[model samples]
Target: MDLFTYYRSTSSYRVRIALALKGLDYQAIPVNLLRDGGEQLKPEYRAINPQGRVPSLRTEAGRVITQSPAIIEYLEERYPEVALLSSDLIVRASQRAVAALIGCDIHPLHNVAVLNRLRGMGHDETEVIAWIAHWISEGFNAVEQLIGDDGWCFGASPSVADVYLLPQLYAARRFNVELSACPRILRVEQLALAHLAFQQAHPDAQSDKPA
Candidate 1:
């Protein structure tokens, strides 16, 4: 597998964590999102993914997959040995709810495109940062209640919820969203930092991370 990724991209980070947790070996193809006015917008990358997004997975058979959620779902189904979702029906739904809450509701609000649009609309840095923080704090406040109190988000083991939540938590901290109110999330963060899979998949551990 070849993973086209940007080190600091939370979407890429989530896929990395999923891959690591599944113990899958793949080539990491770094696409620097910030280099030369964003490499993802270049013709070469656009050819691979017309949307020009990072975290595009190319399988050994030369099939390419896009979108983090879809890629993660493919990985989860393809490699069931390390299940990210629960077998129980209700539990699985709850886990997916958390994933949607972050992926759809929270992450998109602070997406680069959204922030850039805000800037284009004449919103200054302070306002943009505030926009990022407000949504993250609001979403996380709900996530804190949805997840488990101890260990991973769903239970003792990591789930799709944890896979999704951790990346958003990273983004929250990156935007300096106050997290004192989300103790459950903080505890999950601590656990994830200690987990080998999460450690290996972290943005700082990626080869393309800046010096």
Candidate 2:
């Protein structure tokens, strides 16, 4: 398997964490989202993924999968030995809800394309940072509540929610979102970051991370 990813992309980070948790071995192909007006938009990459997005997975069977959630789901479904989702049906749905809150509801509004578009439309850096902070805080408030007093989001072990949430927290810190009030969230982040899987999958651990 080949994972085409950018080190700083939260979406890419989620897939990396899942892969690490599953103990799957894959080649990490760097898609530098910053260099030369973004390598993800290049003709060669666009051919591999028409959407021109990072974290595209090319399986050994020559199948290409796009989108972080799709790839994670594929990994979960194909390799159930490590079980990122809960076996309990309702708990599983709740876990998916938390993942969606971060992956879908919040991350998109602050994605590079959205931020770049905001800049193009005359938003200043401070305003853009405010935009990011607003959504993260609002989103994390609910996340903090949902995550409640658990080592992971839904249990003693990290689940799909934890995989998605940890990356969002990384984004929150990068953009200076205030997390001091959310102790539960901070604890979860600390616990998840301390885990070997997450440690291995961190942005700094990536081969493409800039010094």
Candidate 3:
């Protein structure tokens, strides 16, 4: 398997964490998102993923899969040896809700494309940072309320929902979103940070980290 990724992308980070948790041995192919007018938009990379997105996965069968959520779901479904979703239907629904709150709502609003658009419209760095902070805080506060104080989003063991949340929290800190009020989320983040899978999947741990 091969994963085409960019270091700081939370989407890519989510997939990386999933792969690590699954104990999958895959090759990392870094595609710098910023250099040379964004390599993800380059013709070569687009051929692999016309969406020009990071974290595209190529399986052993040489089939390409895009979208972080889709890739994570594929891992959970295909490699169910170590379950990432709860056995109970209701618990699974709750976990999926948490994942959707972050993936569908928070992520799209603060993605690179949205920030770049703001900059293009003449928003300065401070303004751009403010925009990011506002959205993340609003979204995270709601999510934290939903999360409560548990090791994982649902109950105990790490689930697919957690694999999605931790990376988004990393982005929250990067954009200066105050998390002191989000004790539940902060607790989960700390727990996940201590785990090997999460540690190995950090942006700084990537081979593409800039010197």
Candidate 4:
């Protein structure tokens, strides 16, 4: 299997964590998102993923899977031995809810594309930075309120939600969101940061780290 990913993409980071947790062996095919007007938009990479997004996974069976959530669900289904989703229906729904909070609700607003669009519309750095902070704080407030003081999102074991949460949290930190506002998340993130799976999957730890 080959993962076509950008070194700093949060979506790619989520998939990497999933792969590490599942203990799967795969080749990393780095597609530099910032080089040459973003290689993800180039024809060669677009042939692999027309969406021009990072984390297009080529499975062992030679299928091209796009979208991080779909790819993760595929991994969970194919490698059920690791068991990312909860067996209980309500618990699983809660997990999916938390995952969607980050994946769908929070991330899209703060994505590079959105920020670039803001820039194109005559928004200055201060405006763009405030835009990112506002949306992230909105999402983080919800997560902070719901998370409580637990080791994980739902149960003690890390679930699919954590996979989504961690990367968004990383992005939030990059934007300088105040960690003190979310004690539960800060604690959980610290624990995840210490774990080998999270450490190995960090953006800086990737082979294509910027010099």
| TM-scores vs. true structure, each candidate | 0.98, 0.98, 0.97, 0.97
The sequence of per-residue lDDT tens digits that candidate 1 reaches over residues 17-120 is 99999999999999988889889999999999999887899988999999999999999889998899999999999999999999999998988878999999
- Kindly provide the TM-score of model 4 when superposed on the true structure, using C-alpha atoms: 0.97
For residues 135-196, what per-residue lDDT tens digits would candidate 3 score against the true structure? 88988888888875767777778888888898899898887788999888888888898999
Off by over 4 Å in 3: none
Error of 1 at 168 (Å): 0.9
| TM-score of candidate 2 on Cα atoms, chains taken together | 0.98
Predictions ranked by lDDT, top down? 2, 1, 3, 4
Q: Rate the local accuracy (lDDT) of all candidates.
A: 0.92, 0.93, 0.90, 0.88
Which candidate leads in lDDT? 2
Kindly indicate the candidate among 2 and 4 with the higher lDDT. Answer: 2
List of clashing residue pairs for candidate 1: none
Tell me the deviation in Å of residue 15 in model 3: 0.4
Error (Å) of candidate 3 at residue 156 is: 2.0
- For every model shown, the clashing-pair count is 0, 0, 0, 0
Instruction: For model 1, state the Cα shift of residue 202 in Å.
Output: 0.3
TM-score of 1: 0.98
